[model samples]
Target: LHAYAQVVGAMPRAFAEAHPKWWHVSLKVTDHGLTTDPMPLLDGGTASIVMDLAGGTISVRTAGETTATIPMTDGLSARVVGERLSAALGELGLAGDIDTDRFANDDERPFDAGAAASFWDVARLVASTFEEHLSGLSGDVGIVQLWPHGFDLSFEWFGTRVETHEENGETTDHPAQLNLGFYPGGQAYFYSNPWPFDADALLGVALPHGAQWHTEGWEGSILRYEELAGDPDGPAKLAEYARAVFEAASPTLMA
Candidate 1:
């Protein structure tokens, strides 16, 4: 799934309008799976890449009603699949550079249709929960998206505060923000990390559902997925955790 996402992400990165926040490259959750939305083609048409997790295939479709599909089969290497996608785009007249380095794995991958379907179910639920949380917030909020780089689902709420950074003799100002994300990787977990994190103000604050302030490798609050699994009130508990982090850290972020 991660490999497929990387290839899908490369489409927008290579052809879509470059969003300053790179929102264009992030995949949006669809009813069946994830989509790259639409990328305008040089020929005045548009193209999109769709990962049909439910059907276990990656499809490339063009506005001209052309489509090419690559099956998600066991033992297909990421490189092979990427090559197929690139070739498909070429055949569709929307050829462009697909960063092969981003998915430079030659090892065969096992595809479990049942597991993929289950993941899609969980992704839909989590995306809905994230959106519900975002609706109550006032200010600039990003849409829930899945980042292919880390294969994490997340969104950000921007604060009024501006943070300044200097790099290579250039100075830039960026808005402070808080991210609520779910990482489905090893030991899956959810996190709410505030930019320019104020350790003094945020640490020691209580978080619900066994969530804790993690300051070891990174700074933020995290709640393991296991904490909510099988619980009847899992969604509610996740919401509470998100709200607690916001209430605890928003003040410092705005300050």
Candidate 2:
């Protein structure tokens, strides 16, 4: 709800004074320290400004359908961001349209115009599918497959290429991702590259079941693995953290 709050708090009295009769604002906060439905603040007419910091997004909406969405990062503080937002609005000329009924007539620093809350409920909804989106390239030659193992693990296969099997013990043929396979596994598996055995040095050969490797990063490095495994929650945790960062950077918009 931080986004809505920023817009509400920074709203220019001229805007509120212009539409005081029909326009309003409100906010809905949850226990998880997230905000949603910032429009409610305006609809309720109780508060002119509302902030929604949920689902990895910061959004502020006015009765005129004018909205400000900002991406969030964990490294930044809310107060500093608020000040920056106020200045940005002033520059954009939107600040003058902010509702003023709920704000003091002489409020100069828009950041301190009203109260704020964490919109946790809204956060949960957006963070739901983050873990499912862990797919990317590892290196030029090898194939990187992400599995939900003990930890987030990626297996890179050089030489021949990696393969998969079905329940009937028959090998299945599928196009390799970028000439490599990028399979998304569980959290633990993704966190730590875990497999049945060590498959390094065995290029073009698919090791037996439960064999994978974990990748730390890419620095022109080439390491092979026969098999590997790790913590399960790794991928989910990483996804959640990333979503949180994105949410802080900006607000969500309905395209």
Candidate 3:
């Protein structure tokens, strides 16, 4: 699955100029898995990629040409899969390379089908919850997207509160926003971070079941998937947790 994600990630970087919402927005998710629209090459050809989270395979479909399949047959590493994709791209005359820099871990970690299924299930539930939370907001809220870099599915709500900070003796300014993300991490966590955080905002707030206000390394609230998986009311618990965090931070963040 990780190798498949890398293959899809490369398509965006290579074809960024062809997309209107930049390459980042092209990454999408379906009940089946993560998908990308057929991207156009300068030579009037398109390379479409889909990572079948359900099937455990990466499929490349070229317009007017045969589709290529690379199965997640056990121990396929990212470099090996990338090489296959590069050869496939060459065959179709697509302009791009399978970026090795951000390919992160191409190690031969065995695939786990059962765990992936559970992760996807959690993702769907959280994605729907994101939409529910966004429906009432008037701010600039991005659609839920799966960022290839971190392999985290997330959406951001922009608030007009910008802040300036000094980093390495250089000053930088950034807009305030809240990120609600779900990741298949070491612990599989859902996170909510309000930028330029007002630490006092959540000082007295109590997080919902399965959630905690995380302050180590970063300022944010975390909902551990392991805790939610065992809860019968997982969706409700997540929604409640998000609401609690947003409510606590909105006064300072949204004001």
Candidate 4:
């Protein structure tokens, strides 16, 4: 998906606001691969991008049958994939100066079928749990997206504005938000981060089953997948952990 990230990131920056929550809201797992929610093209038409790890290709399809593909060769590094994808996009008239370095690295792990299948299972479970929690909340929620940078599937929920910053000479508001996602990092886990607050406040607060408050390099909380793999109530525990952290942090973060 690092290649697909390059495609979307290369699309006109003008489309950024239209996808502020940048993760594809309707992304789903088809028998073939992971697909993006339909996106509006600069030409005023719609297209959906698909990342088919199974077929080793990134596909572009119009609302109709017209489709284009960029291959993901078995031995190519991620940077090479992005470059090839960019050239392909240019040939197809999709111009994006594609940023080749958003969470860029040169790891040489060849694709693994077993690992992919297992990771997809965890990703689906996490997405479902997030859907369950978001349905009960009235605050603004973001699309549950899989970002290529961190290779993490995440989304955000917004609350009252807490601060603002100037970016590229434009002012942007920063709201209190709870970001939730599944990441198959060095270890697979469910990660939750509520912005604008310190981890110290919840020092003694009990986490859901199999969770811990981590503050090594950042202030987010985590629950290991290794711990939940055997739990009969894994789904419930994940949702409960999300709720516990959100409820514990929302008020003060919003203030």
Candidate 5:
């Protein structure tokens, strides 16, 4: 929970740097284990943006009582989403900091593999909603990586089709696949140790090609994964990726 709070603290500052046009970003948090119903954070009773970390998944919802939620599985993926939040702040141009006091954590529940499963489900749920919102945007939008819990769903936008692939084969269902990102489970283990945050030996799960870490990029119709073995500066590259994803996805967010 302390680690999550630290990341939460950085979100507002990062968003302020991205798109500094909007006034405020909404914030929210929900957990299945909360003994009492949680309250939404509001400035003047109008819901802005929310960050929900409960049932093992962490999600970010736009202003108003979130009618939509997407689930994210990877802890590292949250860092990417944080980048988007930063970018959204820049777009709003509010010239102030986001109120992140709404972030909630379930301390009663020990962080474990099963708890992590719940977290991934929540992430996929929220990611699906994010895809829907971005698809409807009038401007160009790019989805770099859909890191569902464990597996990485790679995608590229081509006209109306969303090109994607995994270890199995190729898929073109953008919305459907986004929804399916939460399906696979049972393989992930709760990582108690601090995430490597770099290319140092990846501790969670191995990629299909046995690479330690992989990143996704969209170029025309191709979704590319540049896999690296191990580098002393791998952690730095991971940080860069986190910032980029956040900036790219921030436009659609209310925050």
Candidate 6:
């Protein structure tokens, strides 16, 4: 799944309009799986790549009704699949520098259909919860998206406050923000990190559902997915965790 995501991510990075925040490079969750936004074709119309986790396939479809599919099966390297996709795009008249090196893993991993479907279920739920949280906030909020690079689902909310940083004799101002993300890799977990984190003020605040303020390696608050696995109130607990972090950090983030 990770390999496929990387390959699919290359489409937008190579063809879509660049976003300052790199939003153009991420994939959005579809009812069936992850997908790239419609990218303009050289001749006319648009094209998109869809990774259908449930169906266990990656498909490239053009507005002209042309389609090519790559099965998500074991033993296929990312490079091989990427070449197939690149060929498909070429046949459709879309040509650009697709960085094949981004997904150069030759090691093949088994693709479990059931596991993939289960992951989609969890991702869909997380995206919904994140959207709900973002909707209630009064600020510049980003769309809930899946970053193909890290394969994490997340969104950001920019606060009114401006934080300045000096580097190489140059000063730049950036908006204070909060990020809520769910990382499905290696012991899946949810995280909320505030920019320009006020450690003195936030460390003492309590988090619900066994969530903790992590200062080692990276600073942020995290809640393990295992903690909510069988809990009936998991969604509510997730929302509460987000609210806790926002309430505690928003004051320090505001102008």
Per-model TM values vs. the true structure: 0.96, 0.23, 0.85, 0.78, 0.24, 0.95
Better of 4 and 6 by lDDT: 6
Which pairs clash inside model 4?
none
| Candidate 3 TM-score to native | 0.85
lDDT of model 3 at position 253: 72
* Ranking, lDDT, top scorer first: 6, 1, 3, 4, 5, 2
In model 1, the Cα lDDT at residue 84 comes to 84
**After aligning candidate 6 to the native by TM-score, how far in Å is the CA of 86 from where it should be?**
1.0
Candidates, ranked, TM-score:
1, 6, 3, 4, 5, 2
Across 1-255, the per-residue lDDT of candidate 2 in tens digits comes to 233343443342233333321221222223323232222232343212333333343444445643555554332344544554555445444443433333223233322212222223212322332324323312222312111111112322222234465767777743222111222222212122212223342223332233323234521112221122233553344444333322221121101
The local distance difference test score of model 4 is 0.67
Go through the candidates in order and give the C-alpha RMSD of each one to the true structure.
1.4, 19.4, 2.9, 3.8, 17.4, 1.4
Write model 4 residue lDDT over 1-255, tens digit each, in one string: 443444444433322224455443334555546676665656777666666765666677677754667665464566655566555445545664445554254654366656655666667777778888888777788766666556677778887856788989999887888888887777778888878756668756788776878778877788888888877788888889889988887776665
lDDT of each: 0.88, 0.31, 0.74, 0.67, 0.32, 0.89
Query: Taking the tens digit of each residue's C-alpha lDDT, what string does model 1 give over 59-101?
Result: 8878666478888865588888888878877775766676789
- Which 10 consecutive residues of model 5 have the lowest summed lDDT? 189-198
Q: Which pairs of residues have clashing backbones in candidate 6?
A: none
Pick the winner on lDDT between candidates 4 and 5.
4
Show where candidate 6 strays beyond 4 Å: 64-66
lDDT of 6 at 160: 91
Candidate 6 on 1-255: residue-level lDDT in tens? 887898889988998778899988899988757988778877768888888888888888776664898889654888888888889988878788999898787777678999998998899889999989999998799999999989999999999999889999999999999999999999999999998789999999999989999899888899999999878889899999999999998898889
